[model samples]
Target: MKTLKFKPLVLALSVGMYTVVETSTNASPIVGAELRIVLSEQYRSMIEEDVEEDVEEDVEDDVEDDVEDDVEDDVEDDVEDDIPMDTQDNLVDAFEDQIIMSLDELLEDSDGESTYSDDWLVLADDEQLNALEQQGYSIISTEALKGLGSNLVKLKAPSSFNISKDNPSLALIDSIADVNHVYQLAGRFEPPNGTSFHYNQLLPALSSQQLRLGMIDTSISLEHETLSGANIKLHNVAKEQYSQVKDHGTAVASIMIGQKDGFTGLLPTAQLWSASVFFEHKQQAKITTAEYLVKAIDWMIAENVDVVNMSLAGPPNAVLEQTVQKACDNNLIIVAAAGNQGPNSKPLYPAAYECVLAVTATDQKHKVYRRAARGDHIDIAAFGVNLLHANAT
Candidate 1:
């Protein structure tokens, strides 16, 4: 088994799923670049039309006001139109198949990963969904986002642009459909460089025995040598049919509480409630969802955990927003990955949420991680470039 080590935000997992765990001695740091958006030839042709239209409009607008607002507005509008967001547009179907994830070449500094779904999710009860399904609408999946009531329903429908023309009744379902968006791990593995903030200085100044830290990520390895004697308790919030990965979750947990001769956690003796939400779906590439997030956070709050660390990011959803706010209402401190999508990418949530403290990755020299997302949402930077990752045999 070859073990690899990386900082909290990103985890390297096989496409097929759960990876074996071991301490990696020769883990190579892979420098992460912003995800380049490489449009397929056909997709490019379609985008070209829209791009030209936007350019022409910009030219006209610039002619009218070549000053402050024009430049700022164009830059902002161009970004919003380019990056993958809510997919209720003419390009909805194309976005699902047209987008692919690769490094800089195809990377447009996108949301890190170009993931989107065509399913339309809305606030509806089971009876309401059943009525729609009976009337010929396609009901795909459904989930009850705990405190949000049993109102979330996933529907397979046409894009919003065609909804009124093709499925007129769907218009009455909701005003704005929350397209089922997917999120990915927030960081990448890179060669060890730059110095990280040492916990040694703060260790003596604080009482760690009582700090209860809750982590929401993949499954963890209790047997990891670094975690020997650690006070860690884990639970699986993922559905029974799904499988969980441990590499990313263990790395984060080790950082939170693992204790060893050389590697000591932030709070070595602190109690931890490790909630694993990363689960592999049979039909979808996503390992988790907004619903899973709500469940995990609710579990943490029930356990009365003081602080929560989320090493992942994705598209924002209302259920997730409500749950996160609930945590804040409980007076819990939340810190999450600021995202490694690059300097130009949009802020990823729950890190982008106002109540959460967004932390980005940095190298030993304190330089920003090459792929770290930048925006007003970012609150702090930490040493994330240098890490000892794992590879399981």
Candidate 2:
């Protein structure tokens, strides 16, 4: 059996890669050294769509029947009592007007089809179905947007419909009156750099104690050596099989609580509930969608997790924002990577959200990692440069 070694570089609070350092004859590797980290005290904060078609049908039928019966009674009475011809015409016109007004009101109260772009996840009421269907949109799936206590529907556009740059989906979705919000489905984020394998000396085991932690990332290798004694609960919300590579999620998990033989993690006793939202693709980099991420957060909330560690980053999404806010309101702390988009890159979320604690990477000397995102949103820095991590395989 071959044993893999990793060196501790830096700890990325939000998101950044750490490198593994080779050991020298005279200097001891920092893997076993007690890290003196400054903990920041601050940093914390915090749609129903349905249309009842059966009820609408019932109302329509009742209204029509009442109108017809009233008109017939009025006509019969007018004929039998010798009412004037002009009075009879006026009565019929009034009845017709009343029927038209009633129908209009009923139609207004009912949901119509809502229009949206292909890239949007629309939250629309059931009454908007007619308008949406007219615009070539249909519900493909539905999931609970946890904390909001409402279900978010995933909609798809017609196969022939095209969203050109000149007519972006965002603008089209915004024009829709029924849509509460149209959120862009984010693609999977690539893992941090410097993930090559290395050999190192094993560090002594640390004491195990229990802590509630949540992780939203790729599938983890539960049987990995480093995770031998870790209390981990795995949920596959990504709807895909666990990947054999399993590098990203496994490494992140091991860093959180894996322990075997002489190797240890930051929290050997952590009760980790991992929600797998990312999956490895054949030709593309591992990625996740906004829908899966929302589901993962919902699962975390249900588990009553204390802190959530998100080592992934992507564009700002309304659905994600709502979910994060709900998590904070429930007193669950959210820690996200500031992303590896580099110092000049725009801030990524949920790190950018006001309620979340954004973490950047730092080196042994406490210098910021060159690739780590820099912005006012960053709340703290952690070691993530040249850090030794457990191998997934």
Q: What is the C-alpha lDDT of each candidate?
A: 0.57, 0.54
Going through the candidates in order, what is the number of backbone clashes in each? 27, 39
Report the poorest 10 consecutive residues by lDDT, candidate 1. Answer: 11-20
lDDT of 2: 0.54
Error of 2 at 205 (Å): 10
Off by over 4 Å in 2: 1-119, 123-137, 145-148, 158-209, 240-245
Residues 280-372 of candidate 2 have per-residue lDDT tens digits of 544234656666777888788888887787877766656567777877888777777777767998887777888887777765567887777
- Supply candidate 2's per-residue lDDT for 379: 72
TM-score of 1: 0.58
The Cα error of candidate 2 at residue 146, in Å, is 5.3
lDDT of 1 by residue, 92-120 (tens): 44453435321111111123433233445
